[model samples]
Target: MLIGEVSQRCGVSTRMLRHYDALGLVKPTGRTSNGYREYSADDIRRLFHVECLRTLGLSLNEAKRALDEPDFAPSELVGELIGHTRARIAAEAELLRKLERVDAAAPAQWADVMGIVTLLRALESESGARRQQAVLSQNEGASLPVEALAAAALSEHDPNVAGALRWSLARAAGEGLTDLAIGLDSAVVEVRRRATVAIAAVPTAEATVLLRRALDDGDVMVRSRAALALGSRHVADAIPVLLGMVVEGRSDVEAAEVLGVLAEVAAAADVIVLAMQDKLDNTDDAPTRLRITQALAEIPGVAARGVLAELADDGDRTIAATASAIAHTLDRRKRQGFRN
Candidate 1:
């Protein structure tokens, strides 16, 4: 077979076959008359081998060594190729994601495209200020990338940046909520807590469901934050976790305030008062008992007032004084017709 025949049959161009010959990777087996290059069966086989190695991301030099070196060990080279292929795949995937995010922004001009790219980079920047600016610059009607915002919100460590990212994620109209949900199940405890915090303000039913579910989260902080948000939403289902916060003294002040709001509902009042009483009965921790006493101040009606009156004579002097003070305040508020 001649060079043209080998090129045609082996799917390699004639120009490339000549370069292969020049590199001594796959030389022609013989020369035909009038200076036409000729290839024997072994030369065609070597060309096939070169093409095969190239498919595995081998350079031409590496391909020659693979074919010609008698003691060439394929294991190390193959492992390196695998690593390179994986790196290329990851780079391509990231590029695809960047392109998708940019497309979603729907930039109106080259300047807008550049601006969006800049903001995207800032979101991943090492500086928290830049990340925060990226989030804060999002316009009301602009098509900012919600997925990036959600991801940034979950992973953000800086309090200021996390707040801005959460704000932006909510402004995305819940589009990124699904991605944020992944953070709720993250192996990192802080990530799970952040996910709940970000979702807490979304005001969507899906966020509500997630917040409610997080009421049962293994992390106490997750449950407390989720309960606090759920409480603000007037969700009576959070009463139990809110009570648990009172028992645990974790964010008990805020938890008690939310419980007070929920206590406006008659059913919530009963559940909240009963759980507080139950915890008080089982625990001898003074601080927890005091927290429970203060939490009672938020609850209204006869049942809570009765609990306060009984606590006024409690064994602990601080508890007794705190309970007595709350009762007097309630009486004064009642006299002034003040109610939550």
Candidate 2:
């Protein structure tokens, strides 16, 4: 077979085949009378081998060594190729994600595209302050894409930066809701918690619905944040988790406050009082009983006062004293027409 025949049949271009011959990687072993390069059957086989190695990401020099060096172990070279291929793939994937985020921004000009890119780079900065500034600096002039903000919010480990990202999402008018919803489904517990935290700041009904889904998250913080957010929206579904947070003493103060707001309704106040009473009955821990005692004070109405009145005379001295103090305050408020 001549060089052209080999190039045509084996799919290696003529110029590339000549380069391979110059490099001594797959030299054709025959020549016609006109002195044109000719390829023997064996040379074609060697050319095929080089092409095969190239497909696996081997450089020309590496392919030459692979075919010519009897002592060249392929295991190490193959492993290196695998690593290089993976790195290339990862780089491409990251680039694709960046492009997608930029496209989502729908930049009106090259300047807007540059601005978005700059903000994205800042968000990924090693310095927490820089990352936070990236989020804080987002304004009407060069508003960031909501998807970018949502991604940053989900992955940020620093509380301050994360808070800024959440605030940015809140101002995005629910644009980040869909990304945050997908984040809620992430297998990473912190991602779910961050998603819930960010979603809580978004005041849309869609945000409220996503928070309800997070209420069942396995992470205690995720569920607690969701419950607290829902409680602020007066979603009744948060009642159980709110009570649980009080019992566990996790963000118990905020939980109690939200519960108090929920208890403004007479029917809800009645149920909350009973639930606190149940916890007080079941727990022998003085701290837990005290937390329940304090939580009950947040709720107004006769039902809470009735529970407090009963707790005021309980056996635990601290709990009884605290309950007495809170009950007295409730009475004073009622007398002042602050409660019924």
Candidate 3:
């Protein structure tokens, strides 16, 4: 068959076929006398396998390596593919979380408040001290000293200044500033970075509110960070947000991280089971679904039984076998509990 026929049959593009050929990732079996690429039945089969691996989240390089190796075991290759899928899912999850954060801080009032807090903190710290010292040194030998000193001190304590500071702190806390602070120094960077740190410093109750707000933010990066912070705290309130990211968020990595954190929290078996069920139904993206299934199995209850059963019946032999292994482990635990 020619490239066009193979592409039509396999649903892969001719460009992709050509690129694959160039990369030695996929090649035709032979060539015609006129120099057109010729593919055999085995080539079609190889293409199908390559497509399956790609859908499973294997990089072209990884798929080629696995396929090219004569001794490659399907089980081993599946395992490697599973790991890669999990990583990609995690990255997507993170992107969703950042988007939520940006949405929450979209209001001008909110941004102004956060900006004020950053400005005040910058002033009260070493940066402020250096500025003050520089001003005093510059004023040395000037005649109008007493009035200027009083004016400067009063300005520092002005009601407007105080109000701005409070507002900024409130905004920062709302933006998950505490966690943001972990990565910063007194030397200020962008306004967003300052707001991130300041938001992280807010009281837990207030911070939770801010994080929740940001989870719905229009900006992906903001929502992503907010989800990430919420996940870190293992807050039950974040479960829905995390689930939305897993199901719909743009950034697979962030979503995966959120899911991983949620799994660690694993408070409700029903939630994990539902997530597993959803993943199974929505995507044949094997690697990500596998991670979700494994996470579901980790939850401590009988709710996961149905999901595990479904997974045990999966067409992918490796997934089915892994699911069976997990089911057996869970069954042992259940038996032990009954005996006790």
Candidate 4:
């Protein structure tokens, strides 16, 4: 086949075939009387091999070596190609994500598009300060897309940056709740915890519902954060987890405080006091019992008074002293109220 015929049949352009010949990569096996290049069947086979290697991301030189070198080992080269291909694919995928985020912002002009792009890049910057600044200064630019904020909040490891991201997401009025809700089911424990952290700041009823669902997460941190958030929102669903936190000494003080707030309700007070009493009954460690005794001080109802009175003369002197002190204070308050 002549050069043109070879180019047409092999899909390699004539210019490229000439370049290959100049590089000594593939030379036509013969020449016609007019001295035009002519390719034999063997030459066409070599050209096909070069094209095949190119598809695998081999440079021309590497492809030539692969075809001509009897000792050329493809194993290492193939592995390198695979790694390069994966890196290229990852880069392309990231670009696509960036484009999607920009498109989602629905920029009205080039300036708005530029601002959003700049903000997006800053959020992904290596510096935690930059990431935080981007979120905190979001109002200076076109409003950030809520989905971007949600993604940043979920993936951020820096406490300050993550907090800022969550705050920003909250200000978006729960627009990113869908993304955050999906994060709740992530296989990654940190992701779920971060989602809960972000959702906790959102005051919308939808956010409250998501937090309630997060309370049942298998990860203790997720459940703890969700429970605490729920407790602050006056959701009774947090009671069981709050009680567990008190029992396990995990953020027990904050848990106790929230429980106290929950205890303001008459019915909730009874249940809270009864649960603490049950814990006291089953627990033998003096420190655990002491912690529970102190927690009971936060509750003001009559049921809590009964538990405090019984604990006042317990075997542990420290527990007895603390309980007696609390009971005495409650009595003084009760009497003071009566006097008025």
Highest lDDT, which number? 4
- Candidate 2 stretches greater than 4 Å from native: 1-21, 25-49, 141-143, 280-286, 309-320, 331-340
Model 1 TM:
0.88
Would you estimate the TM-scores of all the predictions?
0.88, 0.81, 0.37, 0.81
Task: Give Cα-based local distance difference scores for all models.
Answer: 0.88, 0.88, 0.60, 0.90
Clashes of each: 0, 0, 52, 0
- Encode model 2's per-residue lDDT on 1-340: one tens digit a residue: 8888887899888999889889999887888999989988888888878889888888999989988899999999898888988999999998898898999988889988888898888987999999888778776656467788888889899999999988888888899999989999999888888888999999999999899898888889999999999988888789999999998989999999999988887778878888888888888999999999999889888888888888888999999899999988877877988544
> Model 2 compared with the native: what TM-score?
0.81
What is the Cα-based lDDT of residue 239 in candidate 3?
62
Model 1: per-residue Cα lDDT over 123-226, one tens digit each: 87898887888779866777677777787788888999999988887887788889899988899999999999999969899999989888888999998899
Q: Specify the poorest-scoring 10-residue window by lDDT in model 3.
A: 142-151
Q: Give the candidate number with the greatest TM-score.
A: 1
Candidate 1, superposed: residue stretches over 4 Å from native: 103-116, 281-285, 333-340
The lDDT, on a scale of 0 to 1, for candidate 4 is 0.90
Q: Is candidate 3 or candidate 4 better by lDDT?
A: 4
Poorest 10 consecutive residues by lDDT, candidate 4:
138-147
lDDT of candidate 4 over 211-256, digit per residue (tens): 9899888999999999998988888889999999988899999999
